[model samples]
Target chain A: MLAIVVLLVIWWVAYWLKLQPPHLLPSPLDVWGTFTKLLTNGAVWEAVTKSLQRAFLGFAISVVLGTLLGLALAQFTLFRRAFGPLITGLQILPSIAWVPAAILWFSISTEAMLFVVILGATPSIANGLASGIAQMPSIYPRVGKMLGATGFDAIRFVILPAALPGYIAGLRQGWAFAWRSLMAAELIAYAPALGIGLGQVLQQGRELVDMPMVMTAIILILFVGILVELCIFAPLERYVLKQRGLAGAKR
Target chain B: MSESTIVPDSSPRAVAERSGLHVPESLIDAATAVSINRVSKSFGNDLNPDGSLRAPVLKEISLDVRQGEFVCLLGASGCGKSTLLNLIAGLDSPTQGTIETPGGRTALMFQESALFPWLTAGDNIKLALRLADVPKAEWNDEIERLLELVHLGGQGSKRIHELSGGMRQRVALARALAQRSKILLMDEPFAALDAITRDVLHEELSRIWQEQDLTIIFVTHNVREAVRLGQRVMLMSSRPGTFVRQWDVDVTGERRIEAPEIAALASEITTDLRREIRRHAK
Candidate 1:
């Protein structure tokens, strides 16, 4: 609620100052009008659904792949020695870098969007989990062994729980990457089959020179990011941190 | 709290008897729960420039911990009391000599509670039970029982941060006991607590130790704490840690920190420890 009010105040100030042309910066009222029209037409909801589906799918794939890879890297010396440098290098590369290859490989489909999202997100998740596993206190594994917690039980009960805070942090980073990658993919490859996403709407507004529509699309994208963080990732992160007593009761 | 209630069906006697049956001749021959035979530990593979082997942290340390005995390894900061405890717990290996512990497991409690922060107090105990392969049917009841043992019967659901410093250590004790191990290794577990809480814990520890009959090897730099807790106090010299002196404490019933014997023994150990530290300075 406070964010909305602040955004409105910024919009009013920008309009009063005549900052840029009307085609470049639309008034808050103009963006609201476009929002209402888009809402009534159901286009905003459709775009939101499509974007959410892609983001969630990409996130799921990243989590599974990242966790397994993280565990492998943490547990095996050979794997760590072989892939450690490559993994670090991969983290530095932006998701935008994969756009060309993703377009060629998956050809402007949902698969292409997912490919970029995974490429962007997996390294963060894997690194988070790997570092967390490494940081576990030395006493934990020894206690597990003394109690006969070998094989799967040791990994499941002891190792995983010990590393969970780090893993959750990684997942949060991965989600951000996935969200960004989805927007990038949608902008680059706008097609009917790919459906309408925020990026596609922004692109359409750009072509028609509809500044209010473009501002609406950009606002919607920002809104969606903040909403997801509050509704999904923030709560999840809070719960994990609270469980470990890392986050105080301020939330 | 009920005065006559037993914590769990898995009594300490039963655990002792079970381990007694499995005791190897090597361990039983020494009539001790742990027998360290000329054990020496050193870090790295390098020899000194003078063509002599590097000094060991523990040098040919031979010691025996009799069954159900409370032994304190008293020394200065670098005297390697903790190193010896680690070797005894099988977390590290001795460079030379042999340690014979009756095939039974040893539970160690660190200076920090070291409880799994993700788990609640009850769940932490449950994890120990789960790792020990206690039957699923018995876990819930056993957790409650263990909580009662530590005077935390209703605090099973409390998170680590919710508990006070002293309370967390008690829960840690309950978790360690949940393993049902024959030997318990404690490395300055109470050093971090306030003096009043430390006094309370000292009483709690003695009561629990007496009731449980656990073979404990406690490591501490505090001479008074050693005199107060251990049946026998073994003093180690610094630089290359070697046994400097040993004192058998004779305190009947519940011992007090203010008791003359306790003070006298502490002073004796302190004098010996001081001399050892002074020798290293030279």
Candidate 2:
């Protein structure tokens, strides 16, 4: 906590000294003022809620679809050989790149945002699950078989649990993709029903030429991203790692 | 050794007579626990239509384990002991002959603990119960019973990573037993442990084996381990694994590694194994 205070002091000093332009990077005081103004209006909160809802909805869909696809890809060699390359290729395409296609298909609505989010996230989720299944030790499945686990029972009792760590890792990566894609979709194409997210706030600030508000929006986006990671995914991942004894040491 | 010495006479009468009073002939006929008949396995394929001959891992191996008997397949490294165990477990098929396990289900324990990291120890055992079609009501009791059998009663809630190697293997043993299979195939289950822990587990395993009255086919490279636990030890040759010799051990009552007969039998088997390896070198 003291270290954080010291770092803030250093940042304040740098800002007072005008190390960079105020427009490109606003002073801490200016960002704080803008933050208070936005907070009072309740619009920022609404945007935040909207963004989170989209990200979570897309993430949930990706997890279910990716898990099913990954299982199919891992289990059926014919399916893997047929579509494995395509899945990987899909993952490499940028989420922002899907905006125009999604807009054309779903036509500027929450559906369009969801399509973008799923497009950006599903491949990673699928890949994570697939690799998890692939990396499981051969002995586990044999042990499963000897214990009379066959077909779906084999997958439920043996395969999924064995592959869970990797699958969880995939979900973490998928969330990142989902969040980023939702932001890009909102920024590029705004819908009245979709309302204003942080991405739109940044666009509005840019159009109004209010550099302080723009900087505030950018900082809030970064802050929200870090906050979600720290609050939700980081703790989740840590719990899993600690359970597996992969965490380095306990305090 | 002659072919007759290499393969045991698996005829029903011979097995019934050899298995002694405890194992009934009706059980032998009805419950020929595992039959590996002239099974040969080799990895890799040649470019030629006739197939390039990769050396065989197991060559014309035939063995029969009667119901409720403890048999150890003992051999050094590269002797294809694990391959044979895999064949019996149906994880892999033999290149030449078929293996018939009359018992519908078999359980296997590996050299490593092989517990799932994502699950608690009790959940791991419960998975076996779920697979075996045990009613959900019985799962809790059955899991506790298995944990008790392995002397790990309070460790059901522990994670695999939290347990020591010995404890993990104990949980693994419990999970395997939870299947309640008629036959249990173990591939060097204790080879990774320290001497003291291995000794303790040997006693634990013997006690469990007696209680369960389950047929066990254990594979190990450890000579003393073979002598210490097995009712009968079958030594295998290296490369193309074939039974080189058999020792019907009579050390019945609380035998230890230092027991005179055990040391003597281990020495004899070790010498036989060394000679077989030397013959291959020549």
Candidate 3:
């Protein structure tokens, strides 16, 4: 709430000071009006649902592949030695790098967008999970062994649960990357077959020189990101922390 | 809590004696719970710049613990007493010779309690029971009985974080009991607790030991703690830890940590422990 107010104040001050012309950077009130206009017209909902569907699909696939990759990296010395550095390198590489190659491979369709999203998100999730497992308290696995949880059972009930906070961290970072990658993909691949997304709308706004629409699109993107974080990842992170009594809530 | 009410049914162990981490075609005679035969454990592969081998943590240690024995293996810090207990628990293997717990998979307790923070005290015990292959239907009642055994009755619903250090250890004790193992290994389980809590746990442990008929090999650096709990105390030398001395406390009734007998025995053990430390100082 404080962040929203501060951001609004910053935008209002900037508008009052004429940081940029009205066509370039419009007033917060102007952007708000554009936002309401878009909302009432219902075009924003189509873009939102389209982008969200693609994001979720890409993220879900990334989660599976990333987790498997992460576990293999954490578990096998050969896998870690072979691919660990490569995964770290991929994490540093931006989503933009993948767009041209993805577009060439899949021709500006859902496949291209998904390919970019997966490439962008998977490395961070895998790395986060791998690192978390690596730093897991040594005592937990030993305790599990003593209690007769061997092999897969140990991984499922003991090791994975112990490494949960790390896995959750991976999921959180992975989602952010997925969202950013999706937007980048949408912005670049403005093909008719790609339909419309928030990023495509923002690109259209820029082409038409509509600053209010651009601001509105930007805020919508930010709003979706914040909403997902609060609605999904926040509860998950909170649940894990609460399990360990680290959530700081009064017992 | 009355001691008489905490009597455990022997039927559980009798019925499940065959269920363990690994089934054996033959077990060592029932008289001995554990037999460590010339066991030596050394960290492998790692070497000094001089290309010399590191001294084994446990150097040719041999011992036999009878059924229902509460044996304390006492030593100073870095004496590898925990390494020995770890060997007995079958978490690690001896580099040379053999350590066998024929009775089955041994339950272990550590100074930190080792309770999963994600689980409530009861659920922790349930996890142990489930892993031990105890029937699912019996979990709730067994959890109640085990918590009651540790004098933490009705506290099973509490989260591990909700419990104090001493209470957490009690919950750990209850969880250990849930494993239904014939042997229990403790490595400085109470070393992290306050003196008063430690003393109280000692008494509780003694009562539970007799009631459960468990063979416990408790390792600790504290001389007074060793004398306070164990029926037979074995003192290990420093560094490459090997048992050097043993004494049996002949007292039958309640033993106080500060009693004259306890103090006398503690001082004598401290002397042996100090002599081992002095060798390092030299």
**Top-TM-score structure, candidate number:** 2
Best by DockQ: 3
For model 1 the TM-score comes to 0.86
For model 3, residues A1-251, the per-residue Cα lDDT tens digits are 89989988998898889888877988888888899999998889999989899999999999999989999999999999999999999999998899999999999899999999999899989998898889888898898888889998898878788888898999999999999999999999997566899889999999999989888888889889879988999888988888798777533
Which 10 consecutive residues of model 3 chain B have the lowest summed lDDT?
A: B1-10
Higher-DockQ candidate of 1 and 3: 3
Return the TM-score for candidate 2, rounded to 2 decimals. Answer: 0.89
Residue A213 C-alpha lDDT in model 2: 82
Model 1: docking quality category:
medium
Task: Quantify how close model 3 is to the true structure by its C-alpha RMSD in Å.
Answer: 8.0
lDDT at residue A23 of model 1 (Cα atoms): 67
Q: What are the clashing pairs of model 3?
A: none
lDDT of 1 at B87: 92
RMSD values for the candidates in order, in angstroms, are 7.8, 3.6, 8.0
- Per-residue lDDT tens digits for candidate 1, residues A1-251, read 89979978988898889988876887888888988898788888999898989888998999999998899989999999999889878888889889889989889888888999898889889988999899999878876775667888888988988998888888888888888988898899889776888889888999999988888888788888879888987888788888888888566
What DockQ does each candidate score versus the true complex, computed on alpha carbons? 0.58, 0.68, 0.71
- TM (B chain), model 3: 0.85
